[model samples]
Target: MKFPNPHYPNLRYPNRRYWYVPILSALLLLLNGGVNLALMRPLTDVPASMDKLRFHLDDAVFSLFFLLAAAVFAGAFSVLRRERGYLYLSFFSLMASQQFFWEWDGKHLLFGDFPVLPAESLAVKSGMTFAAFLFFRYLQGTNRRLTDRIFIYSAGGVWAMSVISSISPLASPLLPFLSGALLAIVLAYLLLAAGRFAHRFRRYPEDSELRLIVNGFAVFAILILPDVGKDVLQVLTGQRLGYLPVFWEACLEDTFPWALMQLIFVFGLLFFRRYMRVLEQNREAHAEIRTQHESLKQEVAIRQHMDRLLDALSGSYRLKDLEHTLVAEGRRLFEPHSFHWIPYNRKARSIDNSIDNPGLDSGELRELEELLFAADHGLVPGEILPGSKFAPVFIGVMGREELYAAISPKGRPLLERERFALQLLAKYGALFLDYYAMMEKRISELERYHGEQPWVGKLFMQMAEKERKRLASDLHDEVLQELLAARRWLEGSGSADDPMPAPERMRLALDNAEFMIRETCAELMPSFLSEHGVIHAVLKLADKMRVRADFQLEVRTGTLAAKLDDDLSLTVYRIVQELLNNAWKHSGAARVGLDMDQEAGEIVIRYADDGKGMDAEAAGMSPDRFGLRGLNERVRLMGGSASIDTRPDEGFRAECRLPLKRTATAPA
Candidate 1:
C-alpha cells in the first residue's frame, strides 16, 4: 500500500495549482468508464470469468484503490500524531482492503465459486458506512455543532429504518430504497459543508491545506452520483440497448473507488502541512521570548547601577571629597583612562588634588591644558574631551588663577546616560566650592558672622537646588529624546504582532515626563530671576502659588539699593519661599503678602499671611522643619537678623534684615 508523502515545512505549495488534483481525478473517473465499456464490447460472447482473466486492468485498478486509501491514512497521521481524523481514516482503508479481497475471491480461478463470508461482507459494508460519517464529523468546518447534530440524526434515521425492515420481511424491499435516499442526503450535506469551507477561506487562496480539503470533497460529491445511480439508470432504461452506457455501467464501480482514494490523499496532505506550520511558529515564538528576556535583564542591571551612583553623587558635598568623587564617578560612567587633577605649581608633575601620575609631566601638563582648552571646556574643568586614544575627562581644578577645582571627563563623546551623569557631578562640583565662596575673597567676613549648624544647612540646601536643576536638564535631554524616538518608531513601523498594544500610552507618558521636568527646572531656578532679578522671581512664585493655594499675594520691593549679589539674591528668595510655605501649610492663609527693600545699606524681607497663627517663640524651637527657625538661621548666617510675629487670632508675619554689600558693577 502507498502512503501520502511527508510534508516538507520549507516546501511551498500553492492552492491554485492543487485545483488540478480534483480535476484530474474527475477526468480519470470518466476515462475509466469509457475504456471499460469499449473493451467489454468485443468480449460479449466471453463469459464474465474469461473477461476478468483476459484483461488484468480491473485487477490492477482495484489494487491501486487499496494503495490510495493507505496514502490517505498516512497523510492524516502526518499532520497531528494524536488526531482522530487519522484513526477514522484507518477504518476507511480497512474497508477498501476488504472490498479488494472480495473482488479477488470472486475472480480467484476460472469458474471458481470463491465467495466471501456473509457476515464478513456485511461487517465491511457497515464499517464503511460509519467511517464515511466520521469523515464528515471531524473535518474542520464539517465538525460545527449544528452540522454534527444534523449528521447524527440523519444516520440515526437510516439505522432505525434498517432495523425495522430486519424485523419484518414484508418491509424488506423498501429498506434498500430507504438506505439509498439516506446516502444521497448525507452526500449532499457533505458537499454543502465542503463548499462552505472553501467559501470561508476564499480570501486566503494561498492556503493549500484548506484548498485540498474543499476540492477533495468536491470530487467525492461529483463521483458519488454516477457510482450510486448506475443501478437505477440501468433499470429505468432496461429495454434501450446502448454500448456506451453499458460500458459506463461496467466502469462506475471501478472509477468511484479511485476518486474516493484521491480525495483522501488530498486530505492527508492538508493535515500534515498544518502540523509542520505549528512547529515552525512555536520555534519562532520561543526565540523571540528569549531575546526579550535577556534585554530586560541587562536594562535592570544598568538602572540599578545608575541609581546607586546617583545617590552617592547627590548626597556627598565635602570640599576634599568633591574632586575624588567627581573623578571616580566619571571613570565608572565612561571608563576613561588616567583620571588625575591638572596641577597648579609651575614645574610639579604631581596634580593639585594630590593624585600623582607620570602621564601629566610638567611639559605634558602644558600640552594637555592647551588641548583640553581648545576642545570646548571653556577654561573651567569638568570638560569632557573625546580622544581617539586614552579618553581623559578632567574633573579637578587647573591653572593657578582660579581658586576652585575643575572636573573633566576625558573620553570621545560619552554615551547619553554617561554624559548626563558626568554633567551632574560637574554642576555640583562647582556649587560645592561655592559653599566656601566666603573663604575665597572675604575670609574675614566668615569669622565675623557665625550661625553654627544653620550656616551648614543653608549650604546643603543650596547644593540640593543645583542638583535639582541638573536632574531636570538631564531628563529633558536624554530620557525625553529616547522616549520620543521610541514612540515614533512604534507609530511608523511597528509590527501588528507586537506585544505592547498602544503607542498613544507611550506618548502620554512622554508628555507627562516633559511637563514634570519643566516644572522642576522652573522651581529650582526661576526663569524670571536671572533676567529681571529677585523682584520678578517673587512675583512669578506668588502668581503660581495663587493658582495652586487659592490665595492672593502682593509684593513690594521699592527702595534705594544697588543690585544684589547672587548670595543675597538667593538668600532673600529662600526667606520668602520659607515664609510662604509656613503660611500655606501652618497658617491656612487665603491672603499672603511680602515686602522687600534695603534699609541702612541693609536688605529687608517681610511677609505676612491672613491665617491661623502660632506662638512665634514656640515655632523657633522646632528642628529639621524649614520654617521660622530655618528662616532665622538663614538670616543670622548672612550677618542679618530674623523676626517672626504671630498670635492666635491675628495673621502671620516674618521679617528679615540683611546688609547688602554689592557694587553697581556686580551682576546678579
Candidate 2:
C-alpha cells in the first residue's frame, strides 16, 4: 500500500510505522461481526407469514461475513494508500452490511415485536447517499457542474431532516418521505455518473483504466434500480412492497455485484500507481534533455561572439571605426540601456571632456575617474555611477586610455558568458587601438618628411660629404702615415742599423699600424655587438661610458633580449649608445640606469640619468642636436613609441616600447 516511488525514492508515509491501521480496522470489524452474530436467530423461529421472504441463516451469515471482510480491507487499503475513492467504497460497504443485518422481515431478527425508529433508517440512507456522491465525484476528477450542486443540496436536506426526526418524535412521520427523496437523488446521480463514464470510454477505447471504471459504475447503477423502484412503490401506496421483500432477500440480489465493484476499484488503484511512476520518469528524462540542449546553444553563441570580435579587430583601420564596432557589439551582446566610449587624455591625466555622450555628464565623468583612481588605475566590475539607474560594466581599453561602459537594460547583473565576451572584446579592441595610433604617427611623420624633402636631402648630402672628409682626414693623419712609416722602416730594416736592431723596430712599426686600423673600424661600428648579442654589447658600451663620464651606470636585461632580431639588436645598441652620449656630453650626469624587459609582446627599454636635464622641446628643435632627432627617428621607424621626461635642473628619463615581430625561429 505504501510502495516507494522510483522518481522519489526518499518518499515516506505520514506515519513511520505501517501495521497500526490494518490492526485497528480488524478490531473494529471483529466487534461489529460479533454484535451482528449475537443478534441473529434461527430461520425456523421466523413467523410463518414471512417464510416466502426468509433467507437461510447459514447463507445470511456467509454473505454478512463476506461484506464485512471487504469493508475492513477497503478501509485499510484507503488508509495505507491515501486514496479517497477507496475510503468512499469502504463507507458504502459498511452501510450495506448494516442494512443486511437489520432488514430481516423488515425488522431486527430478535426484536420483531419492538417498534422501529424511522429516524434511524433515514440516517442510514442519508449516509449511503453521501458516500455515493463522494465516490462519483472522485471518478469525475475535479470537474463539477450544476447537477453536483443540486445533489449536494438534496443530501444536506436529508441529513437535516434525519437530525430533526431524532430530536422530536412529532417529526417521525416526515422521515419516510425524506428517505425516499434521498434515495431518488442517489439513483439519479449514479445514472449520470455511469453515462459520463460511458461517453469517456467510447472516446478513449484504448484506455483500459477508463473501461474498468465505466463497467464498475454501470453495474452499480443497474443493481440499485430495483431497490429504488421498491422504495418508490412503498412511498406512493403508503404500504410496504411485498413484491420486493426487504432484508437479506434484497441484499442477496445486490451484494455480489457490490463486492465485484469494490474489487474493480482496488485493481484500478494498483494500475494508477504504476502509471504515475512511469509518467514521472518520462517527465524527468525530458527535463534533463532540455537542460543539455540549452547548454549547448549557449556555448555555440559564445563562440560566434568571439569570432565576430576577432574579425572586428583585424578589419577596423581607425580608432573611431573600432569604437563604433565596440559600441555596436556591446549593445548586441548586453542589450544595455546606455553605452559610451570615453577617451582619456594622458597629458591632462584625466578623461577627455570635449567629446560628449548622452548618459555620462561632466559630474559622472569625474566620479568615474575617482572610481578608477580608487581601484588603483584599473577597471572595476559592475560599478554604479552617481545618478545611474543600474550598475554598468566598465572596460578599460589600451591601459585606460579609453573606456567602454555599458549598463544592462533589464537593470540586473550580467551573466558570466556576457562578461567574458566583453572582456575579450576589450582586449582585442586595445590591440586595434594601439595599431591605429602607430599608423597615425607614421602617416604624420611621412607627411612631414615629404614636405621637407628638398631641405632634408641637401642636409643629408652635406653631412655625408662632411663625414667622408673626416674619415679621410683620420686615415691620412693616423693609419696612412703609420703604414708609410712602417713600410720605410721595413725597407730600411733590410740594411744594417746604426744603433738599434732592425727586427725590433720593424715589429714595433707593424703593431702600431694594426692598432690604428682597429681604432678606425671601432669608430665605424663596434665589432663586439655583431659577434656577441645586444646584451653583451650594451654592457661593453656601459663600461666605456662609465669610465669616460666617471659616473656609475646600472644595466638590467631579461631573457627576451637573447631572442632579438639582428636588426632590432643593432637598433637597441644604437639607441643606448646615443642616450649615453647625450647624458655625458649635455646632462653631465653622475649616475645612470638602464632597464630592458619584455611585456605583452613588446620589448621595453627605460633609461634615466641623475644630471641637470635640458628643455626637451627646445633641444629637439635645435639644428645641431642630431643625436635626439636620430633617436626619435630610429624608434619611429620600428613602429615603437619613445617618450622623454626631462626639465632644466631635473634628471633626464627616456622610455621606449618596441613591438616584437615573430621570426621563423623565435615565438612572438
Judging by TM-score against the true structure, name the best candidate. 1
- lDDT per residue for candidate 1 within 561-589, as digits (tens), equals 57776777788887887677666657777
Best by lDDT: 2
Cα lDDT, model 1, residue 342? 45
Candidate 1: residue 238 Cα off by (Å): 5.6
Off by over 4 Å in 1: 1-23, 26-84, 94-134, 137-144, 156-181, 194-210, 218-229, 237-253, 300-304, 307-668
lDDT of 2 by residue, 1-668 (tens): 11112224333222123243345333333443443343342357767545433433433554476477557657665645645555676776666555555454534444456556557667766866776676666556533667777786788678778868967899988876887788688778767866776676576565545545444444544444555677778889999754334334434233333444444454445435544654676699899999889877987886777688778767878767877887777666665545556666444568666655556666777766655444434554333343433233444455446465544335665565665565666666655666777777777876777676666665555546645765797689877877777687677744554465776767777788797688567646767666887788888778877776777889898867447777687778878877887777788788889998888888888999889988877555455666666677667767787988888888899998877874222101
Stretch of 10 with least lDDT, candidate 2: 1-10
Worst 10 residues of 1 by lDDT: 1-10
